[model samples]
Target chain A: MKFLTPAQVTALMQDAVDAQGVDLGQIRAQLVLSPSERVDWLIAAVENLRAFRQKL
Target chain B: MTFDPRVICRILAEEGTEFVVIGGFAAAVRGSTVLTFDIDVVPDRERSNLEKLARALRRLNAQLRTGSEVLPLSINADFLDQMQVSLTLTTDFGDLDLVFQPAGPKASYADWADGADHVDLGNRLIVAIAALDDIIASKRAANRVKDQAALPALEALSEQIKSQT
Candidate 1:
């Protein structure tokens, strides 16, 4: 197993954080959805993830 | 199993459990684009309400989730009264967290209820969602890496929601 150095780990963590940061465009798109729609969106996303995991 | 929060909310409502939806699901309901797989709620501490919640939990086949170990949970009003912190459980429908005292402004279930917005989830299932301000406050107080990451979008949504009102 290869172990990342401290600096390498920090850089990877920072990249993950950057990738997860907020996007105003996405927020606006989501705002167009009613509360019920939002719930459906979440459920769909979760189902997609579950399917993806089963393939692994 | 896939996460289905609507079914979870419906069960709670059907059992007449008094609870306010909180955490990431609440944020999503209020227009944040964050994707959360679990539903978090703050149930009323009143004995009768706790009994109702217990029935809902049983119907969900809920088990206490502690890291990798899933333990059987025997829930009742007394068990709920002794819980001073959050309880995370995995149900047949999805994950549910019962938060007794969230770390934010007016941190009680009653407080969240006082300012909650009634949202219709269709089919006559209306649930109370914690206000955007309260959700933001709780996330800020939690200060976890994921919570911190979600704050910006939630704050922007809050501003947008306020502007339209």
Candidate 2:
């Protein structure tokens, strides 16, 4: 599987805030995320990537 | 004493040490929010480069960190030249792992140099970091439970990155 470039990661982080109204940086900073909640975030991130990739 | 990694990077760069930051630090540099305790680096294996690294470590007051009897000894050029492939030391700045060969497609510092990412820290301080993809590959190869735990975040981050360019 191809890995993401630096620019792509930065763009995705920015897009998360702009398009999805989610700030992953803030989510990561939250200390109370349960194990399952973190898993959910990962799943959502993957789906986001899939959607973003299709747009390219 | 908690050591800021930016200081560690600057110290190495200022000393003209030939090395690349790898492992968790590299992942973090590329936007993986993985928390890492130590700064892992693959320093060039050449005698001269190792000499430079020894000097930098000395300046940091590096000492072997282990549960066994703590040795008050120090790492110097002559000692490093005769040492093994990897050494883990504790410094005033925290743990600094010197890896001679990282566990990945790129086995040595020279091998990864071309693919490494350069991070400019302003004021003419530049440091090399291993590529995120390679870090992922190495993590997968390591396959420890901790390493396994890091994959999802890194994978998802990779996807997000792939979407950008």
- DockQ for every model comes to 0.48, 0.03
For each candidate, the alpha-carbon lDDT, in order, equals 0.88, 0.72
Supply candidate 2's per-residue lDDT for B15.
85
Top of the candidates by lDDT = 1
User: What is the clash tally of candidate 2?
Assistant: 2
lDDT of 2 by residue, A1-56 (tens): 99999999999976654444333564344324533343234335545665787899
- TM-score of the second chain in candidate 2: 0.92
Worst 10 residues of 1 chain A by lDDT: A15-24
Give residue B118's error in model 1 in angstroms: 0.6
lDDT of 1 by residue, B27-72 (tens): 8888878889899999999999999999999999999999888999
Predicted candidate 2 versus true structure: per-residue lDDT over B9-53, tens digit per residue: 778887899998888766766666555767889888888888888
Off by over 4 Å in 2: A1-56, B67-70, B122-124
lDDT of 2 at A19: 42
